[model samples]
Target chain A: DARVTQTPRHKVTEMGQEVTMRCQPILGHNTVFWYRQTMMQGLELLAYFRNRAPLDDSGMPKDRFSAEMPDATLATLKIQPSEPRDSAVYFCASGSPRTGLMNTEAFFGQGTRLTVV
Target chain B: EDKVVQSPLSLVVHEGDTVTLNCSYEVTNFRSLLWYKQEKKAPTFLFMLTSSGIEKKSGRLSSILDKKELFSILNITATQTGDSAVYLCAVEGGGGSNYKLTFGKGTLLTVNP
Candidate 1:
């Protein structure tokens, strides 16, 4: 069975550190999405790429947070000078145009938990 | 602003009971509404609804979307301890621009045996 894979399932970093999370989308999926979940903010879309090109990153903090799809199979989300408030579970999801109802059913990775102190 | 809201926030039910979870959204360029079952970690895909009055089903879980009312419902029949999890609802919007999903605060379901 194909599934989205993520590395470094858990990480602990001090404030102002640089942290990077990686994801390997299921083979043949053309769209990848990055989402952040917190108690106060719920699930928020940080960025996404379609066909290996960024379609949107407005929700991402331009200064510290960046998301990129280096290749069809690999996507990355990075944080520079990370803050304690940035602590949350980051999820990577992959989808194909042929997916359920209007291509909305996305396959999610077992999220990476980041704790910034 | 586009948003999705889920009701009850949390629920407790006994095994063999039935439960219904709700999701309401106000989104422009709505494309579809999807349901996901999240246990301790990864969220598994459930149902996706795009049109009004059509019910989608898988085993004892079923879902229906009401585009006119801007809401959807997920029904789980004969709940079991294994059914305990967070149920997330997300809306797919910006169909022409790019597929962006706005998710709600999931409903945490607890099924007791």
Candidate 2:
């Protein structure tokens, strides 16, 4: 079965360290999204890309967080000088837009559990 | 900005009991509402509702959306221990958001045998 793959299932980093998380979406999917899950805030949308173009990154931390999809197969979220508050489970999801009768369902990656100390 | 809210942040029930989880959203040009079950891994797809009053069913789980009321309900019949998980509610919106999903704080369901 086709699935979204993510590298470094777990990471523990000290404060001020740069952290990078990677995702490989399912073949043929064009839409990619980045989400963060935490106990206090639940799930938050950080950024997303459609067709390799950045659509919106309003949810992301403008200064420290960046999300990019250099190519269709690879999507990355990076944090420059990460902080303790950045600790959370980051998820990358992908979906092919389905208009009309078809439904749009996002397939999620296993998620990278990041703990910034 | 699109928003989603789920009720009963946590619930506890005995096996074989029925439960209903609630979700409400305020999104412009709503495209669909989706349900996902999350355990120790990533959230898994459950149901996607795009229309009002249309019930979507899968095994012991069923869900329906009410666009007019801006809410949806997920019903799990005869719940089992395996049904324990965080049920997430998300809304897909239109306009600037092509298919971006805004998620809510999931409802943690614990079914004890």
TM-score of each: 0.96, 0.97
| Per-candidate interface DockQ score | 0.79, 0.76
Chain B TM-scores across candidates: 0.97, 0.96
lDDT for B21 in candidate 1 is 98
lDDT of 1 at A66: 89
- lDDT of residue A22 for candidate 2: 100
The ten-residue window of minimal lDDT in model 2 chain B covers B92-101
Can you tell me which runs of candidate 1 are displaced by over 4 Å?
A: A99-101
lDDT of 1 at A80: 99
Q: What C-alpha lDDT, on a 0 to 100 scale, does residue A57 get in candidate 2?
A: 92
Segments of candidate 2 deviating more than 4 angstroms: A99-103
Q: Which candidate is the best by DockQ?
A: 1
In the range A1-117, model 1's lDDT, one tens digit per residue, is: 999999879999999999999999999988889999887787888999988999999999999998888788789999999999999999999987663445557899999999999
Docking class of 1: medium
